[model samples]
Target: MFSKACEYGIRAAIYIGQQSAELGRRVGLRDVAAEIDSPEAFTAKVLQQLVRAGLLTSVKGPTGGFELTAQQLATVTLRQIVVAIDGGDMLQGCALGLPQCSAQQPCPLHYQFLPIRDQLNEVLRTHTIGELAGKVHDGLGFLKQFT
Candidate 1:
């Protein structure tokens, strides 16, 4: 459902949220990478991208780290992070890399996949990261822990 970049972006964002919730403080890239089992350099690069995209903030000095602004952390959607890292429609693209995929000339997977894709997209669009966190917290037994 997501590329490596999108996966890392979402994981890093969630890690930030979880760490902030636990420590009541921002988390650094090294710590986040360790927590999430992501490559340190790659995670740092993604963090930089998120910072540029206004989804995260970084502080410098002895206490330096990355933290999402209140609005960015609360109101931003998973879809936004995925799109920021992977573009608007990873799922909507050609499954076989065909350029002219559509209703008139659908790709191999398109006919069987469009409805599911649309449903998933709708779900992603409706949920914010804060809402997702609330759900995860409420359903921790059923939800998978990432880091």
Candidate 2:
């Protein structure tokens, strides 16, 4: 239940981390967007958010691009990325987008969705980018939809 921007941000971070961890390579915006199947301009904006969050580093000129240190690549979690791009409200907001959808006067699906929301938050909070990327790298999982 994330925004498309948030989704691409997560994927881009994971792919960038994967490249550094697996290939020891730094990635440019075009390459990052290509790998993640995200739009170039949209991905650029998303990457800008990550860079602003200090979760990624970039260089401007020729032979310049983006890269993360091993620790950064390994330790940044999905939760961090989502929060960086979309804010905590994306996870903590009302499921129905209602302003007052809390337990006091719950929405129709509020109770049913609370546990699922908690589970997703925990999963994102606990799982590091490297761990998730490693799954794809090892063929235990995949990031690409069709491939």
Winning model by lDDT:
2
State residue 143's C-alpha deviation in candidate 1, in Å: 9.3
Alpha carbon lDDT of each predicted model = 0.75, 0.86
Residue 15 miss distance in model 1 (angstroms): 1.4
Candidate 2 similarity to native, TM-score: 0.91
Cα lDDT of model 1 by residue, 1-147, tens digit: 687767888877876765565456888778888876789999988888888888778889899898766676577788778777888756567667688889999888988788887877787677766565555456652223554
RMSD after CA superposition, every candidate = 2.7, 1.5
TM-score of every model?
0.83, 0.91
Residue pairs in candidate 2 whose N, alpha carbon or C atoms collide under 3 angstroms: none
The Cα error of candidate 2 at residue 73, in Å, is: 2.1
Which tens-of-lDDT digit does each residue in 19-70 have in candidate 2? 8788887899999898889999999999999999988888788877888788
Question: Whole-model lDDT, candidate 1?
Answer: 0.75
Q: Name the regions of candidate 1 deviating beyond 4 angstroms.
A: 135-147
